[model samples]
Target: DTAVSQTPKYLVTQMGNDKSIKCEQNLGHDTMYWYKQDSKKFLKIMFSYNNKELIINETVPNRFSPKSPDKAHLNLHINSLELGDSAVYFCASSQLPKRLLAGSYNEQFFGPGTRLTVL
Candidate 1:
């Protein structure tokens, strides 16, 4: 079984439509995150949830929302999708890293992303 999984891996829609992507992880992690990969392949974090509580990245737009119903599931919603919203959205899960030295964290495990296209 996959440790992390996403639904409806390919989404193609018009510029004004709204859509959602669902994610689930069986890894029993305490933190979950959403990341967006642009057409240029630049990956950036959008939101993070720890123990079902949200910790939104300040730079993320209000149009993007992340909801975690439980520690194992997280979903992302996008409203008024625009051409600029077209990107591959990835879901990842991780646990609090052990204090390696002072400031570093362990790498997160990413799921296969959902590719969204807005035309």
Candidate 2:
């Protein structure tokens, strides 16, 4: 079973079109997150959801929305997708902070990746 899995591992989209990426984790983790890894190899966190609650990233654009149906799944929706949004999105699973005793600093288990290409 995949600890974390994101669908459509490769997404080729045109500018201004809307798209979505689904993510699911089988690890029974409480916290799920979205991280964007750009061409520069820098990883920037986007959103986090737990127990069907949304945790927004202050730097994330309003065009990006995250939905969580349960603790096992978190999906990302992008509206009016732009060229700037072209990057690899990684879904990750981790333990929630409050419930963690130690050694839990978002030590995430990442999915293979969803590569988004905007043209």
Candidate that scores best on TM-score: 2
Segments in model 1 whose C-alpha atoms lie over 4 Å from true places: 97-104
Question: Candidate 2: deviation at residue 55, Å?
Answer: 3.2
For model 2, residues 60-97, the per-residue Cα lDDT tens digits are 88999898889899999999999999999999988775
Model 1 scores a C-alpha lDDT of 0.89
Error of 1 at 5 (Å): 0.4
Q: lDDT by residue for model 1 over 8-110, one digit each (tens)?
A: 7999999888899999999998889999999899999888888888865759779988889999999999999999898999999988533234665756999
Supply every candidate's count of residue pairs whose N, Cα or C atoms clash at under 3 angstroms.
Answer: 0, 0
